[model samples]
Target: MCKRVTCPNDGKPTWWGCGAHIETALAGVATADRCDCPHVPVEGNPRMFEVKKTEDQATA
Candidate 1:
């Protein structure tokens, strides 16, 4: 089962669990409150991590 988590990009609600229970984890969450940021794919590289900077943070 998936668990609810805060989106790192915008601090919106998101899911962090198996792909099978994505919809179940986000049930009842408002559409606007959902995080729509693109996520880095984790298929072959389980140990890989990525941190995306926002436009403001990129210019700093």
Candidate 2:
């Protein structure tokens, strides 16, 4: 089953689970409050969780 989680990028509500259960996990979350950040694969990392670097951080 999917679980509701906070988005690391914007601190908005998001899901952490299988793709199939995404909808179920965010069923009651408001659209505006939901995190719509696209998932980008981390280079040199093959793990379940990934840390995304912001634009400023990337350029630093």
- Per-prediction TM-score, please? 0.58, 0.61
Model 2 CA lDDT for position 14 = 77
Give candidate 1's error at residue 54 in angstroms.
5.9
After superposition, the stretches of candidate 1 with alpha carbons farther than 4 Å from their true spots are 41-60
Worst 10 residues of 2 by lDDT: 44-53
Pairs in clash, predicted candidate 2: none
Q: Per-residue CA lDDT of candidate 1, range 1-60, in tens? A: 567777666788777654567678789998887887655535575443223447775586
What is the TM-score of candidate 2?
0.61
Which is the leading candidate under lDDT?
A: 2
Top candidate when judged by TM-score against the true structure: 2
Error of model 2, residue 42, in angstroms: 8.6
